[model samples]
Target: MNAYLTLGSVALFLALVAAVAVALWYRRRNDRRTHSLHQLLELADCLEGDLKTCRAGLQQAHAVMSLNPDLPAASEQEARHAIEAGLRSLLQQRIWIRDQAPRASQDQLDRAVSNMIETRSRLGPLLKALDQAQHALDDAMREHIIQRGPEA
Candidate 1:
């Protein structure tokens, strides 16, 4: 009877250890998933901010371009279209994150985050160029007005 009791106690102890191990594994898995989600959310936020900035810059460019009808608008229009497309893509990404992030694997989330980072990096130079163009346009307009004088 004593041997049986000892055997049962050993089995109970093993079961408890197994339970703890499983719990730890689950906890770690959840933590990893949460971390990935947070990274994705943060990237999305940054991308949104960058897109907004680009949109505003485009608006300023448009306003500047409006003053001079001789200026070619095709490029500006193309930039506007690109910005709109980026916004749409960002929205889709947000929706995906909302609906599928929980089920998404770590590799998938990492790849998404990497892609966004690459996009944002590419936008940086484009934004810089946009700003320069706007400034140049403003400068040219100023020069034109200055050359024409107030009495004209």
Candidate 2:
């Protein structure tokens, strides 16, 4: 009888240990998932900031274009910089969405990537506009300079 009790006690102890091990593993996994979610949120924030920066740049470019049909090359350069930065941010955001989105479907991921690519695509026209505006500005500046004969 004593031997049977000893054996039962041993089994119970082993079962308890197994339960503890499983709980610990589950807890650790949950922690990792939480950490990943936090990282994803940070990536989203970065993406948002990039978008805002790009929007501001576009606004500036538009204002310059509206105010002066002949924008300086420098002004166009600033717009280009903003567009590039925006593109980079979009790419980074897509990467994060692809790699870290929790249980995201492949179709969903593909759609997200496509959206980001589309956003990047729109920049081409904006960039062209900036270039054209800059050229016009430069020509205007040249014409003005000629008229002023270096006095203005």
Candidate 3:
């Protein structure tokens, strides 16, 4: 009878160990997922900020262009289209992250984050160029108005 009790005690101890192991494993998995989700959310926020800045720049450029009929608008139209496409792509990515991120592996999340960083970096220079172009257009418009006189 004492031997049976000992055996049962051993079995209970093993079961306790197994339960702890499973609990730890689940906690670690959840931690990893939380970290990945945080990183993706931060990246998405940065991208959204960049997109908003670009959109605003484009709007300012359009406003300046509207004041002058002679200013070429083909490039501005192209930029508008590109901005729209970027917005659509960003939205799709957010949806994907929401729906699939839990099931996605760490590697997949890392790749997605990397791609977003690359995209955000690329937008930096484009935004700078857009700002420069807008400034140049503004200067040209100012000169044109000045040379023609306010009354004319």
Candidate 4:
């Protein structure tokens, strides 16, 4: 009876130890996975913020151009150049994001890049028009000032 009891006690102790070790291992693995997922989410958030800022800048430039109607020839040229530069930068940024982003995010980045590229292509004429409008307005204001004489 004593021998049987001692053997059963030893078996029970070993079983408990194995169960504890397995639980610890599983918990550690779960924590690592949770941490990795959080990091990915944070990265995604940052990328989205960058995209929003870029979009806002582009929109503001568009709005400014829209408000002006008879800008000078030189001003039109400058605006076109600026627009081209912005478009090129956007294209490069899109390419970088698409390449560096994780597979899960690549599609979203790619679509955004495509849209931006298309918009950029379309902006050339609009930018020229805006420049022309702004320059014309400036020239007219200058002429009015000159005609009015220096000061009262």
Candidate 5:
């Protein structure tokens, strides 16, 4: 009788240990997934700031182009439209990310984040074009000022 009771107690203790270990594993997994979601949200915010900066640069280029008609008209127009389209797309992406992050599965979050990053790469060309347009506009304005003297 005593041996049987001892065996049953040991079995119950082992079961409790296993249950605790499994619980801990699940908790850690949930934590990791939550961390990934937070990271995605942070990246989305940073990208939005970058897009805004690019938009501002494009606006500046447009203003400069307006003030100096001799600047590359075609390039300025292209840059403006490209930046506008980029902003629209970025906004849409941010909306999707925000809407989906909270209740998303780990695999889905991973794919969404990776895809967002890939799409962001496309914005690089648009930003580069904006920079080039700005430089050309600045050069034209400088030349005009120099030709007209300090007082114009």
Candidate 6:
């Protein structure tokens, strides 16, 4: 009877240790997932802000076109194409990160974030072109408005 009780106590102690270890592991894993998710969210927010600016530029371009129909410069069109491509790339990365986050290890999550940061560099020239396009479009729209009466 003494031996049996000792064995039972050891088993119970081993189970408690295992439980605690598992709980600690899960907490660390959850923290990693949360960190990755936060990174993704931050990246997405930056993309969305840039997208908003691009949308406004496009709208201004559309307004200019409505007045002249042929006012879009070749550079403006090229810039728009580049911006669109960058946006598509960002969207794909976002999807990949979200899909992998549920099952990926901490290293994998970090790799994904690093890959996304590298991809984001392509946005630099695209954003510059977008700014130029916005300025051109703004000028075009202003010119159209000035040429026409306030009734327009």
Off by more than 4 A, model 1: 1-25
Candidate with the larger TM-score of 1 and 2:
1
Query: Poorest 10 consecutive residues of model 2 by lDDT?
Result: 67-76
Error of 2 at 59 (Å): 3.8
**Candidate lDDT (C-alpha), each:** 0.88, 0.64, 0.88, 0.56, 0.77, 0.75
**12: Cα error in model 3, Å:** 14
Candidate 4 lDDT for residue 146? 84
* Tens digits of per-residue lDDT for model 4, 52-136: 5444554544455445444322344464466466656655754555565444343454455455445544654555665565566
For model 1, name the residue pairs that clash: none
Model 5 TM-score is 0.76
RMSD of 1: 3.1
All candidates' TM-scores?
0.77, 0.47, 0.75, 0.39, 0.76, 0.56
lDDT per residue for candidate 6 within 56-144, as digits (tens), equals 67666665666676574445567567667867877787787668777777888788777767656665577688678778777777887
Candidate 4 global Cα RMSD = 11.2
Q: Candidate 3: where is the Cα deviation over 4 Å? A: 1-32
Summing lDDT over every window of 10 consecutive residues in candidate 6, give the lowest-scoring window. Answer: 70-79
Instruction: Write the residue-wise lDDT of candidate 1 on 13-45 in tens digits.
Output: 999999999999999988988988998899999
Ranking by TM-score: 1, 5, 3, 6, 2, 4
Residue range 73-139, candidate 5, lDDT tens digits: 5566675686677678767866777786677788988887787677667766877876886787788
Backbone clash pairs for candidate 3 read none
